[model samples]
Target chain A: MTRIDYTDLVGGLGLVLTGAAVSYVSISQYPLGTLQRMGPGMFPAILGVLLAGLGVLLSLQALRRPGSRPDIRIFSPLFVLGGIAAFALVIVPFGLVPAILAITVISSLAELRVQPVSLALLTLALCLMAPLVFVVGLGLPISLVRWPF
Target chain B: MEFLANIGLGFSVALSLTNIFYCFLGAFLGTLVGVIPGLGVLAAISMLFPLTFHLEPTTALIMLAGIWYGTTYGGSTASILLNLPGTPANAVTCLDGYPMARQGRGGVALFMTTVASFFGASFGIVLLTLFTPVIADYALRFGSAEYFALMLMGLVAASTISEGSAVKGLSMVVLGIIIGLVGMDSQSATVRFSFGVMGLLEGVSLIALAMGVFGVAEIIMSVRRVRTADIDPETLRLKAIKPSRDEMRRSWFPMLRGASIGSFFGTLPGTGPSIAAFLSYAIEKRVSRTPERFGNGAIEGIMGPESANNAADQTAFIPTLSLGVPGSATMALMLGVLMIHGVAPGPNLISSQPELFWGLIMSFWVGNLILLLLNIPLIGVWVRMLTIPYHILYPAVLMFICIGAYTSGFTVLNVWMVLVFGALGYAMRIFGFPGAPLLLGFVLGPLMEEHFRRAMVLSRGEFLTFFERPISAVIMALTGMILIWSVWSAEIIRRRRAARAAGDGATTHEAREG
Candidate 1:
């Protein structure tokens, strides 16, 4: 017998878990008053229950479909997310230049075929332009150069 | 006479040198980003949102509105030259616009789209002038119940009409609402889902969310499929831009039809430019005598969808301005900006802020004119932009997204949030969830909750008050009808597929028996 698809089942499970987490947080962390004169938790708790119900519905729908293998990849998401994370981590302590350089170099690494010359050029261009646009034109408070050392 | 006086007041403000320069700047930047394949108008606007923080509210709105419509004009450039849609709304343009380019008519296609876009913008401006006052006046009668019903209808429309599974879209909307409900509650002053972070008190920043979903996600998507486009120089010849008399004749009615259709859908919340463009293309195909000529560079193919997209881009402002309900993510961003500036967008906005409304209206015309001037004679510049490699472009775009997120609240937490949502956005793209509905839900969540709470309070805990009010009841009924219709349609489609499969099985069995 052909196996029913679990791709959407996984999605449904994710939704249910998220919903459950939200509901738990709302119910326990905040006060859920009566329906008419509601507290902060009332709306979120309602939404959370509704989400869980929809997640179950989605899982049921997924069961009727023919299963297809999932495609998995790791590098692009990792490097791309790492790029932003690196920028976020560095921008405060080390400031904008290193952060901008780090993001440019790291994000470019996500490409299947990375060209070193172009990456350097991109880094150089962003290093020059980021300050011009964010700092000079907009006069944002962030400094261009601040080294912890 | 009142209309004329109002317009005169608008012109007086819009014609100021400062406003005109900013209007031109907006148009220029809009076209610049619109010419890039993965850099959408939303990304561009969010990246530049901080620039407008210093300008007066009216001027800021004028510039932002310029960017919105200017994108429609510039979106077709990539479609014509590289067969890549510069924006998602321009996807329909590629059906014929690319073929026209392959046929050495790229110059003419670009020129015709510019004219069509101008016609569409003019039509939408006329509609905006005619309808805004009427709608605002009508909206003035709205109580809490009616407002609640309307917002619910909008939210329902956004989720159901969006691409992918209705259930999935609904789930995304709910998720968005949950995200929106985070931070401190206005009434109870209770922190709902901040996880005890001090920065979450102001709520998730809209700029961060936009940059994450649109900008950073785009960079990630483009990185995997990055290729440089080669533009044919012959297509940019000045003489090649002029269409023959027959081509012009064929295009005239399609532009008008497209603009009319666009204005209708654009005024309806949740049905935005992409849907309008697709609908116009479908209508054009159905109406055309030579439907067979559509994919082979039919003039109507480019003219209809191009006009419709631009028209929709302009008229989408109607709900945002008059009703305080955003029609699209871009409109939501604009609405957000208005709120940030202490200007409320609602029925009272027209009476209270005549300068802002009229000046913004007038500036759209000036912006369209600037776009025409920018896109037509300066076509060579935008075409050249198509040649920049994805490797170089994505990094620059990523940098801007980072800065945009950081500046939104000037907090490191916002940048971190951008990273988190960016990864989620990429995942959603892979899984076939529509981002626009989620965005619309996020933007409107607080307003919907506010209206819901107010309506309940007014009714003294009676849920029937929503239906007791005539306008609210009618609106809610409309929402229910749409939900039912989608469900019915999904069932029919499922049944048809099953029957087709069964028929195929029977055919195979008969062949084996024979």
Candidate 2:
């Protein structure tokens, strides 16, 4: 009995779907002229088809071998990505200091245990450092604080 | 005399106070990141890339190149003391380096690796000096067909030679090509996969993509498992670093051999320091009289791979600087830096921007010397850095990534792209796809398309044009061979695994009957 690698199975399916979607959009929307004067769609259409073929091959291959299960965690991605998202959302509206604070507080929660005092200290330190380093030292035009009312 | 004149010009540019300061700063930062586990050269370079936007093109490149090779010098530090490879290229060093550390010879391992790295880098730099001009001259004659075939070979070799499923790797390359198509088509002005977003018109930001895949995703993966190293401070003292005469004797030949191997691989498109290091270790083990001493702290083990990786780091510039074709993702990023600075990289770049070319090469010498100084007496600082908790490190790194991405274009949109790609990268990691090939493909995608389209147009739609030109024919043949060989070897490995499993099962059944 051969074990199916769920990772490969899922990845292959994802590739196949993406490839199909890309190819469909490229073919439908753009003009793929003859090879001599190749249009915008020609290269992508070819690449998309090639990708679909490879994905099908990968899916078939996954069933032929026993695979190890990878240890997948949700806690890290949820917080880390959430932190970046928060920073992005806040950087424009709130400003650099608030954005840094939002990211620092949110991302620190990714760790299994967090020390409240250190997290606060880190946030404070970053609020000072980011402005000094990115704004004053590098002269980027980011505002330290802004009220978007 | 002309060569000497060129060397003198290189020194003039490299010795300028501003360039020297930036070079040192780049080396110092590079070593800092390389010594810290979980930070990679790619991430560090990408993080600092925005800072270069303000500088002269030559100065910008000198600093980035310093970081590029400087990581090789510092990567082995953690490998020796903590048994953690600071960069993937240094992973082979841990087999012997860690054991040597456990035996209180950590200083010797660290000192010798630095020496080997310096020697290897010098050897590579010499080759770069001699070969780049000649290669660039030869490359000036290349047409669209030759360029297209060569890029195809690079893409194929990069994906196939990397660890894990070649199919998965190749798929990632194609996916990158798709991602690269997000911007407007250059030839026809036709907008691509932009999905109606205004930012997408400029295509995905390279800095955002690099930070997402290499920086943010790395933090996500390593946040849980990164550990602090417990070091004996005594092992880092200057007196403890001197290797015995016999140990030094054994290491010299291995370093020489390793540098030779590394330099050869470095010039090849798609191969880089990690492959070079692994190969050097394998060769050293095979050639040694006592192969069993490998995992038990043989000096040759550390010397060979350390020299190999560093040498490979230096020589990897040859293809990039001469042919405008990068061998690896890091080289691709360097190329991207050049393109961003509005300096087109190709054969003419060497002649047109001789100062940038020669100055960068010469700066490698200064940077390596600086790294030697930093890694030796300043070793204590890096060791202390190892003790910083992951809790503190991850947040700061996350902030840097966000800030770096945002600064690349002064857009909040790039930061959001970081999050999106971070999720995508994390997912790819779980599914066994490598990020390097995707990056290499992404950087090369547009260039490859241009050359390919041009070639087809020139050949009047003849599909056989790629195989017609002598240089392109040879390159295309090699690409085909690599594809077939990778598939064949994969089949062979699968069969061997199956046979071993069957054998194990049969043995268990016999034991049960007995």
- Candidate with the greatest TM-score versus the true structure: 2
Summarize candidate 2's per-residue lDDT along B45-138 as a digit string, tens digits. 9999888999999999999988888888888998999999999999999999999999999989999999999999999999999999999999
Using Cα atoms, each model's DockQ against the true complex is 0.65, 0.76
| Docking level for model 1 | medium
Q: Which stretches of candidate 1 lie over 4 Å from their true place?
A: B501-514
- lDDT tens digits, residue span A75-129, model 2: 9999999999999999998899999999999999999688999999889888899
Residue-wise C-alpha lDDT for candidate 1, range B1-514, written one tens digit per residue: 9989999999998999999999999999899888888888888888888778888999998988888877778889998888888888899999999999999999999999999999988999899988998999999999988987887788778788756688888888888888888788889888777877999998888888888887878777777685788888887888889999999999999999999999998988778888999999999999999999999999999999999988888899898899998867788889888987889878999999999999999998899999988889999989888888877778778887888788876788988998988988887777666777777778888887888888888888799999989999999999999899877877788678766756787543223333
In every candidate, how many clashes are there?
0, 0
- What candidate 2 gets wrong by more than 4 Å, as runs, is B506-514
Best by the lDDT measure: 2
State model 1's lDDT: 0.85
Global lDDT of each candidate: 0.85, 0.91
Give the interface RMSD of each candidate: 2.1, 1.6
**Ten contiguous residues with the weakest lDDT in model 1 chain B:** B505-514
